[model samples]
Target: MRLKIKRSNEQRLITLPDGATVSDLLNEIGSASINIKVGFPPQTIDISDTSKLLTDSGIKNGEMIIVTDTIETEVPVNKNEVAIATVSNQNDAPYVQIDDIFLVLRKIPDDNSCFFNSVGYCIFGPDSIKYPDSQQELRQAVANVIRENNQGIYNSAILGGKSITEYSQWIQSSNSWGGAIEAQILAEYLDISIWTVDIESLQVYKFNDEMASRFCVIMYSGIHYDAMALKLDTSLDEEDSQICVFDKFSELGTLIEDNVLKLTNHLKNQGYYTNTSTFILQCQICLATLQGEKEANSHAKKTGHTNFGEVN
Candidate 1:
């Protein structure tokens, strides 16, 4: 059986006879100290457990095994760790509640539309027909709103020095990121408030001051956006079951606020946030280490390399 071994973003194919063990693979790879993980959500293999066979260890052929010098473990949803109460909403959708409001941070795909994607997910829960099938649609909607809905307000003076036409054009561009203006426009467009939890400062910025029937929460981690939803399952094997939209009742709002504070505290405890102003970043394309968001943006514009990751 051949296994694809990945280390440091590079992969190699190795063929071993049937019944090869971790010890055998280590001997073949000539690495004495390494951590090995394989499979979806990845299962850790104890390097010291030499007697275990690859076939028995769930590392199948044609599968990929990641080898890292440092040991790594998946961050659990910790759903059970949070106090849970299960109950059905009027729509009969499943939800876990903490003070009648449950929200878990969901990692959004980092295609550079994370803000729109997070908002889209919250505006219409994943299964709803009203959900935009693509973030492109949301981006277009934002552009249109700027162009037609509130032209005088979203004009040059307020839109980060860009003219309204230019801002609209930029919003339609796939590489553009969303911020407070987009959030406000989108919240008003949806007629629901948006509470963006800034993980760095533990600040919750509210959008849309008008009375609304419901509200949604999104988490901001430095340069990226992720949704805060009601997680139904904690197990990592299955994809998360979540509900983002919630009714705007007074008690529920307070509960959401209190629970959100708890959630942000939990995230801080887990080191799940990035300090935009100080966190070091690495440009994935050229492996250039940058100082912070400012440098990262400069690098992206200069090199047209949009992919970046926080460097610890």
Candidate 2:
């Protein structure tokens, strides 16, 4: 049997034995685990049981199968099960139904302050006016939160080797990117919970979940970040993807969390994933293929081959 390997930019083919199980394929690909999708439009086939045969697993000949060394489980997904991996997000519709409510993204501009803009959109409603300056206020707010902290949590180790003062200045610059640490600070500063979901991995990181009953959702892709909103109307007539913070144990909160999880997992299965570990980068200068971002950066530093693109 032959399988297709899909990465960020390139795809490769590998031949497997008739009895090659999921484990055998993983061993062949040099990955500990993998996410399998086969057939046209691609369906997510459970690769949890490594001993299951490919044919029995519903993989067919010459079919397009996306390969990855990762599996994300939000709910307890059973083994050897199959699920439709199609994306329902359309330009006209642009939202999905989660019970009675609708889920949609309030897109944030990618000016390197996407994180700030996204958080701003979450804090203020979807139609907020804080996006113009890329929300420099949030950056300064994050800087102040870190600067004023007496505890050593925002120390150099967490600052990625920069001193607290230096980090504050750097983050205050218009071009800096805000991430987990800043997220935590803002969660504390605003006294609200924040949940950021990675579409690729479908992992949700919750900040200040305990302190506040209010939380906003944000979606992150390889390129940039966006805010998640929930609204009542099915159509995009209403621009508010209403802020979804609620009592964690309450019925509404549970329902919203479940639906958000459902949406993320569906998107992940639909091949909306970015495998940062195995990004296929090619140097435009020497035509050298690099494995990942680390290798690409090192390649640029060593050979001065900075201009690069996807392998395509």
- Against the true structure, candidate 1 reaches a TM-score of 0.60
Give the Cα lDDT of each candidate. Answer: 0.68, 0.65
| Candidate 1 off by > 4 Å | 1-102, 127-133, 149-151, 232-242, 282-289, 297-309
The residue pairs in collision within model 2 are 215-245, 229-241, 230-241
Model 2, which residues run further than 4 Å from truth? 1-94, 244-250, 280-312
Global lDDT of model 1: 0.68
The TM-score values for the models, in the order shown, are 0.60, 0.59
**Model 1 C-alpha lDDT per residue in residues 43-72, reported as the tens digit of each score:** 577667787898887778888676655421
Q: What is the C-alpha RMSD of each candidate to the true structure, in Å?
A: 16.5, 23.0
TM-score of model number 2 = 0.59
